[model samples]
Target: MRQQIDGAVVLTAADEDVMEYLPNRGVFMAQLLGRDRGNAFGFYRGTMGPGCEISRELHTETTETIYILAGQALGIVGDREVPLGPGQMMHVETNVHHGLRNTGAGPLEFLVIGHPDF
Candidate 1:
């Protein structure tokens, strides 16, 4: 069943479900909002342990934007590698292969928003 937000919905961390995207890598994600919730886009929060990296991948029809919330990471967009930290943001265009790697000593947390419900 799709969840419908009648008005303003406040999602607390304690109410969210955390999933492991990669086993034994300390990579976890929590889906905060999505089309199933009546949103036109998808919103997620991800955390990566030090030295962990997301395998390179791309969205064929959706564009993704990520905002670093804590710690540091290296964002690989196409052929460039950009260092990002808290308060920094990165955009990955549709069909562009991209990935992120935690480069800090601590956990790397970030918010991911994708258009068209990725």
Candidate 2:
């Protein structure tokens, strides 16, 4: 048996399958769009109120890229913490310990894309 998938069949932000992950006080609205047994890809919209943040974690095989949409946040890339604002992008490699924190007056909003959908 053989199955075929058209990657351009049209996948939307809403149709990507949204899920909420509230880890260490931060909020994540994840939209999963692609998958292939061992690999997957998705986008995550994160929200963080005052003093909110995500716990540092490492990826086994997945990598991530994030785009700041609104507000400001502190992005921990490896050992250095980078300040992020609107239009800023962050790329986290696999096995790297990274996290995000809201350090602004308002809520933080950003888009995160990752592999394996994890």
Steric clash pairs (candidate 2): 40-116
Model 1 off-target regions past 4 Å?
Answer: 1-5
- All candidates' TM-scores? 0.89, 0.77
Give the 10-residue window scoring lowest on summed lDDT in candidate 1: 1-10
**Model 1 residue 11 lDDT score:** 70
Clashing pairs in 1: none
Q: Candidate 2 on 38-117: residue-level lDDT in tens? A: 25676566666778888788988989888899999899988999999999999998999998889998888888888767
Q: Pick the candidate with the highest lDDT.
A: 1
List the global CA lDDT of all models. 0.87, 0.76
